[model samples]
Target: MNSNSQAIKLFLVVAFSCTSLLASLTPVLAKPTPNRFDAKTILAQAKTFNQPPIPSGSPPKIRLRGGGKRAFNQPPIPAGSPPGGRVRGGAKRGEPACPTPKIDLTALVPFTQEANSVINVWGQTTVEHPSWFFYVPYTKDSPYTVEFVLQDPDANEVYKKAIALSDKPGVIRVSLPSTTPGLAVDKQYRWFFTINCDKQKNSPPSFVEGVIKRVNLSQPTLKEIETAEPLKRYAIYAQNGIWYEALTTLAELREKNPQDPTLKAEWRNLLSSIRLDDVAEEPILPGTP
Candidate 1:
């Protein structure tokens, strides 16, 4: 062989040797084995493993030490829970804290008399005597005493009293003092109810932050009619005893004067609408006014 051919033969041999070495070094990766243990065997192995004991202490506990695998088991909660503590409301822990009682003045107004018959038209006649209605809801240990307070807009207390012992929600009714006989008709009032839960007093009675509903006995008065021109028409309608037209005219008047004409006429119509009992006809109408 010539020198060049001999060199080519030598190069071929070197390349084959390098390829063989590389093939030998390449790693043959093995496949992972599938877990084939039966359920019973797995359970037995879990039983054989030892679990670490729980570190017992007060709430907000922190774990500094490592612990072995264990099933989750919670501590039992005590009964007659005190304030500021979590109470269970459902299957979940620490939910739905106890609710506070809310006292509200549904209304405060004058006692109207249609021939000595007091009215509660706002309550749709379901309520009588027209006193202040307060709704109180409470849940606490036995013998809870709550105070109800009535005051003016200026924060001058008008009435205050303590109510005792209820395991559930309750309604409190108090008669409005007729100090000035008709003072309640147009005046604004404020009220609140405080609780002494388990003989431990809570925050002072909270003020009901809303307006008080007032009552008026007569149809929009003469002065009110001037503010709303349509009311004069309604008064004339009522005065003319045109019942249907007066009723139809109300819708138009209501848009202009919701306070005076519409409300007053609505109330008067309610009084004349439903007759609770039959009235006996006087043989001759008792002399007309």
Candidate 2:
């Protein structure tokens, strides 16, 4: 073959070899890696945990509760009310005087539907001492008495804690203390977050309650969680149907790294997944014991 023809043949071979090599590596190099925790992919993987759907077996364990009025000590709903019974909503925190910040007290929880009459939401956790989060619009300038209560399935009280919000308006967390009894596995416990808006003597306070069950993590799932980095630990939890852990981990991460845009985007995506878009933008405060 002439020198020119030989050079042309060699160039063709080199080009074809490189193309084949790239084709072989496409899946490994270009495919999305689990550790990436991209907003779309991580949130899409979140389908594995769809905000703890409204369960079918029993009536909703969570509800707006307290004595209906100043004199009533019992829950407002009569005994044996229907499946979707109306629970009592305590006094509303009237419009405060200064600059009007967010006026509603909100729980950082997954809800089946929103209303003062009823609340239907349940989140699962693998840990015994799980932390509950909320957005408290009332600052020290416009404070409210907040209390946390945990109850057994029989409507009996388990642990009662009082929270003091002495800071600015923002999100706050209430952690089940080590002194309190750790949650029993597979048993649903009811918890109430109450804000006494008026602080009236013998008056019922505004409260929202939810049911949380502790479950044993599978061996393989536990291994995955132990090895996951901070960027993906929350995603791992969410993929396995652990709602409290998923939300808490991500919220803690976002609180610690406030300036990271990637974390912010991931936070928004996670909250928006379950229709909790309203309280997504509130600032997270340092949690209490």
Candidate 3:
């Protein structure tokens, strides 16, 4: 081969190798994203799972905060305050605002490995800090204190706050503030929703705990949700098994369109799918978390 020809061939070989290397590295860093589940496909599927493709067809066990196995048999919201606390949301005339028992503190999640009369559930998220929900059976006037704690995978404290809950009972949500540290993607996080009924605050408080894993969504998938109709976002989130955002999106929609019959039915169906039918018909109380 001529000198010029040989040099040209060498340069071409080097260029091809660099291209191949980049191609290989690209996939390693860029994980595969989920395909957009459009309205047609979502409608075709009658049920939306807490999370689909669960290995055992059941939810994975929730990660307990502080690795403690302590169980609170007492009601999360102890019943002691006066029975009459000014019925605000048309609560029944005779219904006990604070029941002696039958505490119905529930975490709004699908995957639950155990419920020892309290709650333990887990799910995934695509955002830094996602919102969590619960079905509170007590009114804001009820005698109780609320505390929410978030911990990282290493069990390190990330954010902790004592929330002041108001408004009539039903469903409520807690979202980490903008200043709170964002959850790292791929790392697991654990949270505790403890309602301290004891005046001491040191007693073993009844709580609902859940685990969360932050995942990444592809650019296209992100774009679709951001640009699509506001209500459509909920369906897409549900189809992808993103419980946190799905529930939040649905809740917000319900707040704006309380009379939306379709949303009302969907709210029931989503809760029913996870066997939370007891609080299925409960109102999504309007308020900031």
Candidate 4:
């Protein structure tokens, strides 16, 4: 072969080899899309609250965590009312003005067809201390009261407490105290968080409600949860479709590690997956005990 022809051939061979090597490495070098906590994915992998063989087939054992205190002298709802029913009335004349109508006061529940603006949560729990979360808009330190009411499937009030809101506006979590009665297995309970913008009003328009049904976790899932690292536990909960526990775990983690970029990103992604981007960027403020 001529010298020039040989030189051209060598260059072409080297170029072809480099191109082939690059093509081979592309998949390895490409970044995998970050895992997002999608509700559908959770539903597929995790057992639903409605599943049989309920966990701890008894009432949830309540354990006081020294934060949420029960309200005293709160009147019980009259008997024969609908389950998850609330008394309705306009705000009384003299109370902290209601939040701007534009404010999106929402319950941080799963994005399901069953969930509406009224705030409906789902999933199962084995713990007596299940916490609920809400996205309260920035009211510049405006004081608010969150009245938590728990009712059985028949709508009879089982437990109710009105917690005072002292934290800055953001995502706030209210945990039920251990003193409260435990939730029975395989039974659905409805809860409400009424933001008493005006105490005088019988029922403020700004309120949320959700349903929770406790179920037993599979043996393998429980084992995995027991062995999973603290940070990884949220993923486990999410994968199992335990909405309350997963959100609570991640929220607690973010509260402790406010500056952690990874946790923050995970929080954002999780919330965004449910179309809660409006309050996704809101900081996880220190909630009132």
lDDT of each: 0.35, 0.65, 0.66, 0.61
Residue pairs of candidate 2 with colliding backbone atoms: none
Better of 1 and 2 by lDDT: 2
Instruction: Residues 1-289, candidate 1: write the lDDT tens digits.
Output: 9999999999999999998887776544344456668798787775543222222221111111122111111111112221111011111223222243232212211111122332212111111112443334453364446565656546677666665534444333444444523225444444444444333332332222222323342455435434645545444433433322333344344434545643543534322222210110101111110
Candidate 4 TM-score to native: 0.61
Task: Write one digit per residue (lDDT tens) for candidate 2, span 155-224.
Answer: 7888898788757877788888888788999787788777675555355566666677788889988997
Question: What would the TM-scores of all predictions be?
Answer: 0.28, 0.64, 0.63, 0.61
Of the candidates shown, which would achieve the greatest TM-score relative to the real structure?
Answer: 2
Evaluation by TM-score, superior candidate among 3 and 4: 3
Model 3 is weakest, by summed lDDT over 10 consecutive residues, at 70-79
> In terms of TM-score, how similar is model 3 to the real structure?
0.63
lDDT of 3 by residue, 1-289 (tens): 9999999999999999999999999987787766567777676563434333333323433221122221111111112321111101112233323344343777787643222322335666888879988777666686788888999978899999887766766788889888998989877777877776667644555566767778787888899899878667776676666778878888988899999987887788677666666777988877747
- Choose the strongest candidate by lDDT: 3
Q: Which residue pairs in candidate 3 collide? A: none
